[model samples]
Every structure is written in C-alpha cells, then in structure tokens.
Target: MNAFLKFMKRNYKIVALVVLLAGALFGFTMIPGQKENDPDKDKLLIELLTYVIEKGHYNPAAIDDTFSKGVYKDYLENIDPSKRFFTQADINEFSKYETQLDDQINNRDLSFFYLTYGRLQQRIKEANSFYKDILAKPFDFKADESFNTDYEKMPFAKDDAELRDRWRKQLKLSVLSSVADKEKMQDAPAEDKLKDKEKGFSDEKALEAKPGADVNKTKANGEKKSFTELEKEARESTLKSLNDYFDFVGDLKQEEWFSIYMNAIAERFDPHTYYFAPDDKDKFDTSMRGSLEGIGARLQKKNDFVEISELIPGGPAWRGKELEQGDLIMKVAQGKDQPVDISGMRLDDVVKKIKGPKGTEVRLTVKKVDGSVKTIAITREVVEIEETYAKSSIVKKGGKTYGVIYLPKFYIDFENQDNRDAAKDVAAEVDHLKAQGVDGIVMDLRDNGGGSLKTVVDIAGLFIEKGPVVQVRSRAEDGKPSDKPEVLTDNDPKVHYDGPLVVLINNFSASASEIFAAAIQDYNRGLILGSKQSYGKGTVQNIIDLNRFVRGSTFGNLGALKTTTQKFYRINGGSTQREGVKSDIIMPDKYSYIEIGERDSDNALPWDKIAQAPYKPFKNNFAPAIANSKKRIAESAEFKLMDENAKFLSERKDDNNYSLNIDKFKADAAKIEVAAKKFKALGKYNSNLTFDALPYEKEKFKNDPALAEKKKDWYESLGKDAYVNEALNVLDDLQPKGGKTASTEAKKETRIKTR
Candidate 1:
C-alpha cells in the first residue's frame, strides 16, 4: 500500500488559487500541436514547477549550490543505482554541472539533462555487450574474493578495462549465488526439494531448462551435475536474467527518464513532494480512491518472469483462489484467445495486458509454487483493496471480549464522500463492537503512513466528546508559518464508544497517524501503546493539477505536482515533525534501536511547537495499566528475546561485505542463521487469544469464502502477536472498577504526560 502525507480536500482550493495566480503571472500557456519530446514542454515544466513550489510549498528550499548538488547526486544515483555503467570519465564530465544546475534551472536550460541522457544511453549499450561476454563462460568462484556492496561509496571505474572488470565481478556474484543454491538443491532431500519450489523456476529463467537445450530438465533435475556443469548452467541462467533486464531497460522512453529528473528536483524540497507523470497521476488517484477496475493481483518482475507479489483480498484473483503469491506468470490472453508470452517484457506493459474493463475475462498461464504450470481465467472487476480499509476482529481473552480494529491507512474518496472511508468504516466497526458487548477496543495503527487529515479528526471524534482534534498551520505568502494555527475540532459532542481504549502504533505509523495517536494521548482517552514512537511526518501535502494552469495547451498532459502546503500540530501544541508521538507503554521491537521515520530522511521538515488548543482531558486514568504493561514486558522472556534480537539487528545493520568464495559465503550465512535462530521463538509465540469476525461479518462469509479466508488468516496472525496480547492485558487493567463511566478520581491519579 502507498502512504502519503495528504491534506483534506477543503485545503486544495487555497493551494490551487495560489498556483493559478502564479501561472497567470508567469504566462505558461503553450502552442497547440507540439511534437513529442518537445524541448518547449521541458522548459515549460521547469518554469511551472519552480513557480508552483515557490508559491505553494510550506518551506521552499533555496535554489543554490547545495540544492544543485543534491539534485546532481540523486539524479545520477537514480539512473545507475548499482554503480554499473557511467565510468569515471563520464562522472568527471558530468561533475561540471554539479554546481551549475541551479543556474541552468533558473534559465530553463537542458544542457545538463541532454548531456547526461545521451551519455547514459551510450554507456547502457556498452554495458549490455559487457554482460553478454562476461557470462559467456563459467565464473571461478573458488577465488577467495569479497564484493563490497556499498555502491554509494564504491569508486567508479577509471577506464573501459576497469568498467569491464566491474561488470565481471557483479555478474560473477550473481552466478556464484545461483550455482551455490543449485548445488545445495541437488544435495537436499526430496522433501526439502519439494519445499524449495516456492522459490520458483520459470522457463525463461534459463536456456538450459528449455526442451531442446543440451542440458534438459530431466537430466538437470535427476542427475547431480559436476561443479563445471552446474557453473555452466548458472552462467546461462545469469545470462538470461541480464538479457531480460537490459530488454526492460531498453523500453524506457525519454519521458520516463525526464520524470526521474523532475522528481530529483522536486524531492529537494522534501522527501514527500513529488512530480507525478500523467500515468502515475492516474495511479495515485486510483490508490487514494482505494479501488481499481481490473484484475486485482500485484505483479513484480522476478528475473525474466512477472511474478504475483500479492492478491488483493476480496478481489477477483483472490476470490478465484487459483493465483497465489510467488506464482510466476508466463503468458496472458483474452477470453478464448491464444496466450501471448510475456517473457522479458516490461512490467508496465505486462500489467496493461493483464488489466481490463470489469466483466472481461483474462486467462493467465502461471507456474505455480509447486513448479507445475496451469492456465487460470479470472474475471476483471472493481477491486477494492480490502486491506486498505478498516477491519475489526473480536478478541476473546480472560472471559472478556475486546475488539481489535486494524487501519492500514486513513483512506477516503475525496470525489465521493458517501463512499466508504476510514473514518466512516471505523465508526461503523466501533458500533459493531459495541453491539457485540466488547468491553474494550484496540485501534491498530501499526505501519500506517497517513492519509486524509479530515479522516483522522473524524476518527478521533469517535473516541472522545467534542474537542479540538488537531491544529494545522498553513504557510504564509512569505514562506513562513501563519500567526494563528487553525484548530480542527470535532463538532459532535456524542462519544461513540467510551469504553477502555488503546491505540497501537509503531515507528512506521506516520502523519495522520501521529495526529490521531497524539489526540488520544493528549485527551487521556487512551493509552498509546507500541514502539518508542510513531513516524514523525507532521507536514501536509496537496496535489495541484499542473495542466490546469496552462490554458489551451496540447503539450500532452502536464501531469500533477504534490507539494507540502501545511504543517499540522498535536492539539497539545507540539509538531510531530521529527518527533513523532511518544508511546505511553513502549514495547520491544526490531526498529526500536534503529533510526527510521522522518528524522532519518535528509530533507524532512523540522519539529516545532504552536499554541496548545483548549480542550479538557477525559477523566480516565491509564497509569495502572501502563505500569502493569511495563512490568509484564520487563519480566517476560519473550520480550527479553525480542530486545536482544533488536540489539543484534542494530549491530549488523551495516554489514555489507560478502565473500565470493562458496565455502566462506556458506559459513557466514550459517553463522547468521545460528545467531538468528536465538530469536526464532518470537515467531512461534502464541498469546492464547482467540480472534474471530463479528456475527455480521461471519454471516457474509457463506456467500464469499474469500472474506472467510482473509479473516481466518488475520485471526491466526493475531494469535501469534505478543504485542496484541500485551495490549489486551493493558485493556484488562484499564477496565473501570464501577462501570464504563466510573470515576477514577480517587485512584491516586498517575498520568503519562504528552508534549
């Protein structure tokens, strides 16, 4: 799922007005009937972006040497991620524009882009030839060499010979890994071999596996090939993989490359601000709407094959149950039509072939997890990403039924408010839980990356009585925060559910998530539980249609720009920018000791404070629950193991060197496996809690088995979650002594103060 720091629809008009004014003043109108790859379009885009960002961005960065260098470094890295292609000479020649990009952008110059794009094409062609020759023969993995994969720090090749050696080393590492895996597979037991089929072995993966190849499948599978033969087969496999990669790369158009360059400039303002191309803008809209009219399976390029990465729950592919994750798609065909092989095809092109209008049928020839090929036909339909919406489960623990609602994001349909949104769905779930006699509720916001700001306020309203939910500050025309922060409040005085509450969060919970958690903590309406803090993304972005500014322009889709327009603050006056909402009951997690979130980003906005909004805290005390949870966490062996694992991960996070020698590589891997085995019990822990769908949802399972399966999996996962168990225990402690409205005033109040 994609998470964005988007503002409410109400704020769009303000930003749009600013952009419209800037566009009129700048005169971005273009002549109609411009040819493709028009230099005029590029110049207009540069002018439009700079003007819009300066007019609308919350904190626009200065277009100086620093910004120019960042764009230069990021653009180069984006083009050649692996440090392959582009020799030292190329870098030297391009370095001239490192500090001049600022000047070039100001003048609407394309010299830097033109030079780099042309040089990249030449290098790519050269490297394509280099790989074919490098993989023509077996690699000598017996050499005791190591490859340092810190490509960012790795020096570029000085000459053609050095560049060729670089390619040789990279290709050798790939082939060596495959050879080692094949050797182990040959030695593995039949049962182990059967289990390994999940890794997949598509036909396009190797010419040696083809029917007429000298080393056919029968001989390769049944017989133990010598090291020489295995190495040969691996080289062939590596060769095919590279062929597919270059083939995909060759399909890249100038527009695609230009999009990358444009984003490099946009991201200099902040990590979240982006320039979405025409097609990508449509994708962003589809994701925000949480529905797509097509086959609902996510595909990714796996070597030469397109593999099913995930099947969207409740969608046609998921309902069909024929297509599973890890299955490699070989071919696609329309209803009753001949299947077209998609091997070595670009992923976007393949997706176009697979997706169709609703009610149309598409047949897929996929290599299943069991290495068996099968053709399955699935009808295209309007697939709502079930996981993106709010869902609740009934948790039976200690003779008390509590509800756990997992919200992946604060999704909404801006164009259609009547359609389901996270706020509406969550309110409904709360109503359902109350009907089922749930004594408490756990709002799971783990890994949520934020969405509609309006939804966060609405959802927060469900827990507490009428109050200020959050504070928002828009940037003034001078690119400074406004004098008065707007306090967004819940106008409704009705509290939907006033029972014991707990909000679960992690380092990945961001933006709107931080706002919700902060409101709950600030109001003393719930105990914020989970990792050290939520992701600190307090900035709000609004998408501006760039095409709107250009009147009567046939430049072919000017696309859209998402730029930071405002910064939100907790009702308590603190911005969750780099300092996300702190958890009341901190739990041990793998990311606890590691740096992540907005603080880790290079261009993230700074944290600050605003005047606190006027709101009274709920008269509920959560001290006893927090103390009990901390005590349980400190005493439990499960938590102790998790803490140790977190430390272990922190220590090894920077280890990037890997041995090329098979024996050394295997020994290092075994050592890691042994060290990792110490924490294996973490995955096996069972909280002994039974989770089930409510009666309303269970009734619908008869007609939709996919829903039943999804719920079953959710319950199974909940059963293994130690964090949920702790949350439930905290809920137990939070249960009011007299009743739901009981006064804890005499309980010697102990409160966890929030910023």
Candidate 2:
C-alpha cells in the first residue's frame, strides 16, 4: 500500500495549477455549524475530489457508462466479497443505478450510496442472528457436505432461507476444521508432539483458544476429550470470534464508509489514487513522521475488554513501570476528569482516548494480573518507532566481513526537514560499515514499498558519481506526454562505499525502491539479486490537502487526496510501470510462479519508452559473479524445493472446494500433507552464518533489554535466510583478487542536456 510521493513544496507549478482549478470550480455556501454526517458534506467531498482528479491526475479516466460500471462492480465486491450478506434480490434492486452512477457523480448525488448502505446494515443484523442460532446446536459431521470458497464464481442466494443455509454451511466448515486439528493433537503420541515442537510447529490447541476460553475443554490441559466435547469447544471459539468481528464492524462511522465510495470513483483512473478521511490522513502522517505524541502502548481487544499487548520501550508507559502487559483496562480518564467505561468500545476509539499531547496526563483503571484493581497515571511524550528506520548487521562469511543494510521504506518527515530520513540514515550506515572494516555490502530492499523520491536519489548517490537517477514525464492538457522528460540526478561525485556491492530486491519492492535499483543497474554499480523482478509501480503521487480549497466552513478537517501526477521511467528509457526492474541474478521464491505485481491490476497504466538519458556504465564486470550464483542456484536442493512448492501453490490456486464431512475431510487433508512433506526441509535450512550488531548498538543493549531481545531475534532469522547467504556468495565473488575493486578506477559520465 506504499507509494512514491513527491512533496508539493518541490513541485510549485502543480500546486499553482491545482489552486487555480479549485478557485474556478468551487463556489458554494459555507455552513459554519454543519453536522459531520450531513448530506451536504458528502456532496462537497464528491465535488472536490472529482475536480482535483480531473485537474491534477496524470491520465484521468472519462466519467462515462464504462467508468460507472467499473465503479459499481468494484464497490459491490469491496463491500461484500463473499456474497454472504447480499441476496440476488438485493443485487437486482441495485442494478438500476449501475449505469447511472456517472451521471449521479457529476450531479453530486448520494442516492446510490444511501440505498446500498441501508440494505447492507439490515443484512448484517439478520446475518448476526443467523450465526448465533446456527451455532446453538451441534453440526451433522456424518452427513456428506461440502463448501466451495470460490466466492467470485458462486451465485447469490435467492431468498432468506437460502441465505441462512449458506451461513450454516460456512460455520459448519469452520467448526469442522478446528475439530479436526484438535483430533490430530489428541491422537498424537508424546514423543511425536516433542518432535513437532523441534520442527518449529506451534501448539494448535493453544493458538486456537480465544480469550477466557475454558481450560478443561482445550488441549492445553492434556485432556483426551470425546468428539462431542471438542466439537462444542470449537463452536464456542467460532462464536466468540464472530462476535468480536461484528463489534469492530459496528463501530465504523458513516464518514468512513463514504470514504470507500469516494475511492471507488477515484481508483478507476489508476490503482495509486486514493481518498483519505480525516483519521486516515492522521495515520498516514504519523507513519511518514515515524513518531507520535501519546502513551506508547499496543492494545488488543479481548472479548469486551481491552488488554495491554506491549509497552513500547523508552516511552512514557514503559517508563511508568506500573502497567503490565496482561493488565485489562476497564476505564480511562483525562487528568482528574471522571472515568468513562471502555467496555465493548472499539479498539481505535479507546486508543484515541488514551493518546494525548506531550506533558498531558491520562489515568487508567486496570485490573492487575493478581485480580487487584488499581488506578495509574502516565504523562504522554513523543515515542519514535524504531522499526521505521534503517538497520544493519555484520556477518563474517568466508573470512570476509559483509554488512547487510535493510531499508524497510524510503521514509522522510515532510513537515520537518530536519528530522531523520532514509538518505541520511543510509549514509550513516555506510560509514558504520566502513568503520567495521567490512569487505562488501548488501542493500536489502525486499518488500520495501517505497516513499520519498528525493531520498531515493540521495541513496543511489551513495555508490555512484554524479549522474541521472530517473526520468519523469507529466501528462499535458492534450492528454499527451510532455515533450521532454525531466532527468533527476545526484550531483555529488564522492562514492561512500566504492568496493564490491550488491542490491537485493523482491516482488514487493516498488516505486522509489525500483528507482534506486534501476539507477544502480544502469550504472553497473551493483548486482541486483533476488526475485525475477521488483513490483511494477512507476507512478508518482502528491498528497493534496483538501482544506486549502474550502473558503470557510465548520465541517472540521476535510482530509486529503493522494492523486497520481506523473509517471517515472528508468534512465535506460524503458518504463518500469509493468515490467519493473529485472534482477541481474534471478532467485527462486515462494511467489515466483504467481502474478502479484502492478501488472496484475487491470487499472494499471500501459508500459512505454522514452528517450534514454546519457550516462556512463561502470567498468566493473559482474558476469563472473552472476554466472557463479546461477550455477549455485541450479545445484542447491533447498531452492529446488522452494521452486517445487511455488509450482504446487500455483496449481492449487483454483482448488477451493472443501469437504465438511469429517471422514472425507481428513482423507483429503492427508493427501495434501503427503504432498507438502517434501518442502518441510526448506523451512529448516540454515545458512550457519553468524550476524552481530555493531559496537554502538551492543552498548545500548546494556540498558535496554527489549532492544537486545529484538536484535537477537533479527540475527537468528538472518542466519536462517538462504537468499542472504547467496547474496554474500555473490559479494565474495566480486571481491578484488590482486588489485582494487572495479568501481575504484571507473570514470564519471557527463550529464545529457534536456531536449
């Protein structure tokens, strides 16, 4: 869900144009005290969103019947994908507005949204009662029954009776599966259970147990219960899960649902354009800022109570030392104000109540682990999310130390330029690795769904001399590409780590990640190793604050819109929109045989080419290293198993029919177990490499035990990674034998003039 964002401050022309369009298109009465759910507010949102997209979007879709139909289908599927809530009668009634939505949107009509929303609420209420009634009695496992999970191909129920039957079958299938798991654990011998534990298998009974579940009825007590007892316990767990799900759904406000309808209209143009409500806008800002002012504690809903899941280290809650992880929060109060009961309240609403500005106090009434009720007060402060920043580890392989820097995203705090960013953090990491006397480095970008464009340019500049990083072209008023593409370059000539280098990527690496990889590949600065290709997202979006367009209104925050403003291409002139950036050394992964990139989206833009920018390729020849990695991959048994697993999953993608009959279901499951046994060793494969934290981080562990534990788990996971091991092997091959590395003697290339 990440995107490449270009700050509006850096693009003045686009901002000016958007402001002019807003001034010309909007002229409405400003209601100073309008209610939040007023229809006029929804109309204003629709009008404002459409105008922005039409004026700022790179290639806006025509709002005609075809566009309306796409929105209609997407909106329906998004609301109820399983076809459980809505019957055929409901669909038939909603079909009248399928082609009228485009006209309605132009007129700022809310008729269709109201009709569908009202019907869905009624169906949800009916379905809730149906589940409770169905779970009240025991299911007939002896009877032959089956459930097909291919909801897309299934037809809607014709009447209320058929809908109830559908609900019954779904619940029966769920209970049957849980019962089968319980039966397996009870039937297994003690030695077999220990063997399973050694293989990293979890305790199925413990995992399936919900909060406040009966201890005597579950496998946790090591009791061998009858089939009837296990079935009853499974049913109880399912009921609790459903109740919790409905509770969360029941808390969603009307404005939140309206945001979905707004996005349905925006996404027809492209997949990246989206509409963010006020709360969602705040969340997006917090994510980009990597810090928030609040009592830093993770909470989870347990039945009707909220439990403290974790206390973020170095935050106010953790520093208090009075609150524990298992404490159940019963009431919350602001300073000396009266406590408000939070029972059955939504988790997000509880979080909103607990979080406050820095130096503010919030008191919590919590039930302690020992059943003692106590009131505790904590002062809020800024809590930085440590996981958002870049981290590195050093490992010694074949007598050479190599540093692996993992960048989760190209993050930057847009509101404050002085805050830490990906470019600054990455440069610091390079300096740390050099101080550690490492022979080579690996820039791990797998699953990094991009961020700022400026950070990518700066990060790419770490290895190469001054040159073009990427080329971007905007759509003009005539719906044609700009005459000349703007070439973004890194002007610095100094190389941070000029020695042997490798950049690792996978199917989830996108946007700015692709830009960095493409720059490295184009300059021949490093070998791109991992999946066949990265995620094919080449579009750039800018967040437009919607409040700026409104003159004077008490509608509160109008939120913001993220619209696609331009498309980016690689310096080689080829668009990475659909093709992404191909790896120099292709690696086998679990998703290798599946379609999961931007190309999988039907609304994605088409791939094209532009004039290539002039730049010099490094003299370093990676052919020998690439050839060696290919040879190793061909002979490795672990990779071969992964490839086989990928093919097995691809073949089973459409096999959604599941048997509800106990005997038949067990037989079907045994066949799958036998087939999946070959891939079990892939999980246990270990590289046997030793990865350690740098000296500075290790020193901090003396006072921070949580940080120590987190890094310990990270190092353990890295030691088991086969992909990281192979990347180290490639870096070993790239090491200079009798002279300096290839990049040391490379000459800089001159920048090409714009057309």
Model 2 spans with C-alpha error above 4 angstroms: 1-12, 31-37, 188-222, 244-254, 283-387, 413-419, 435-437, 475-481, 554-556, 693-712, 745-755
What's the distance in Å from true for residue 731, model 2? 1.8
Per-prediction TM-score, please?
0.83, 0.80
Model 1 steric clash pairs: none
Please list the residue runs of candidate 1 whose C-alpha ends up more than 4 Å from where it truly belongs after superposition: 1-10, 26-33, 199-221, 283-388, 414-417, 552-554, 701-706, 739-755
- Give the C-alpha lDDT of model 2: 0.78
Q: Per-residue CA lDDT of candidate 2, range 175-245, in tens?
A: 78767766776677778654532222221111111121221333557668899998888788778767766
